[model samples]
Target: MQRSYSPSVRRRRLSAQLRRYREQRKLTAAKAGAALGWPQQKISKIESGEQKRLPAAELDKLLDLYEVSGEVEREALHECARLAKERGWWSKYKSAFPGGLPDFEAEASAIRTYEAQVVPGLLQTPDYAAEVFRAYRLLPEGEIAKLVEARMARQGILNKVDPPDFVAVIDEAALLRKVGSAEVMRTQLRHLKHMASRHNVDLHVLPFAAGAHAATSGSFTLMEFPDPLDASLAYVDTPTSTLYLEEEEEVREFASMMSRTQSDALSPIRSLSLIDKIIESSIEE
Candidate 1:
């Protein structure tokens, strides 16, 4: 199966490869830009993947300059450049995701998520997602629907041919907290149980007994890519804005926090049981 690639990953890969080529030729960004008759900063941007879209003609010129002779290698990088330019599925609903979480999720090979208040976005049901949007009060009713659709679209990663390895550690409060209606919550719990059964997904619940854990700060997601060439990133969602942390130390700290929190959480089997109890209580009510 052809590995599905996200634009974000492709961009990073392309930039890294270009930098390697330039370095091998002993060319600085300025010298390279001079030779290509482009601004020096443009080279830096291209190397940083900030340019977003690299024209095929320009890519061809760069490949020629790099003396990339092997047909296989050339074609691979050409495809990378092409994918980097293509917008992710979520990009269509631009207003919904200003921070580009979808782009990161699209290419993530593994994701470790911790949620304190509600279901993680990837596992949330449509009704639950709508309620979340409504509660935020940031979007009008019309815009909320579009955002919900976009959020649902992000879940597609879990069902793709080669899905990411997803592990979620949720606080006990999230299970007890009501999102939409009782029915919506029930459906969400059931969905979580089903998702946990998937080989790629591991769901854990941090019980109330495990009070004041490492992640008391709030919810965050640590996304890791398959290619070691691409760096891991951590996303922290706050009330006002989402912070995407890429600095090596910060990402490592978040990763360590997730690991510690997971240690304090209920095992998958016990977490499922807790969910079942909650589901039963909801039914009795």
Candidate 2:
């Protein structure tokens, strides 16, 4: 059977649809809440993916209020309900995952990521990943194991028969950072070298010489889906909360920025050489 989705995943889909419906009808959250006899805060919570569940009756009423039509739209809402109630494998490790970061990562079909500090999670080796997790210091041992396993499981997507295309633009600073021992760093770099050879993976490195780039603001990920009907998503991770941007114009802007950054970065072949040099230097030290 297909794996069930987590509640947060369901919430995100519902929230996006609800926001689109409201915008199409030119209704603000306050105005919609007023019409439904619900608090504005509740409406906002639902839209932000903070509210885990909603009453079926309330959802139906809201759909009617928004004047949503057609069987497809109606079926979308029903799917949201089913996904919301379904239990995902990750649900068992709720104590480890904060918010819905893992869920979002899992659902993404094509991930375009730019990292300024450290290697992206999907490319991390088990030892390097453990060190990174140790930095968090929020979860117990069992929970940490579960979290690590979930992260490793996500890598399976890269090896699937029809793997998602991955385009990563990593900063030179990231390669220079010694997260673990020199040995661990060497292994990780070698692993990256291997991944770069994969047809579905494209690795680029933004050299220090490429100063003052578009991604100087921070790291972000743009995820695209197979279905043309689904909107592309842009994710910005912060210390406290993660921002998920789905607005067509905003996502387009991020895509443009990423393209510019990638153009400035070294090609896959040169990126591997750079990483190798960094690893050798670290080993020499």
Per-residue accuracy of model 1 over 53-91 as CA lDDT, tens digit each: 998899888888888899999898889888887776677
As for model 2, its CA RMSD to the true structure in angstroms is 3.5
Judging by TM-score against the true structure, name the best candidate: 1
Error of 2 at 204 (Å): 0.8
Q: Candidate 1's C-alpha lDDT?
A: 0.90
TM values, all candidates: 0.90, 0.79
Per-model C-alpha lDDT, please?
A: 0.90, 0.81
lDDT string for model 2 (96-132, tens) is: 4555555655555789999999888889888888777
Model 2 bad stretches (over 4 Å): 1-9, 18-50, 63-73, 135-147, 227-230, 247-253, 280-285
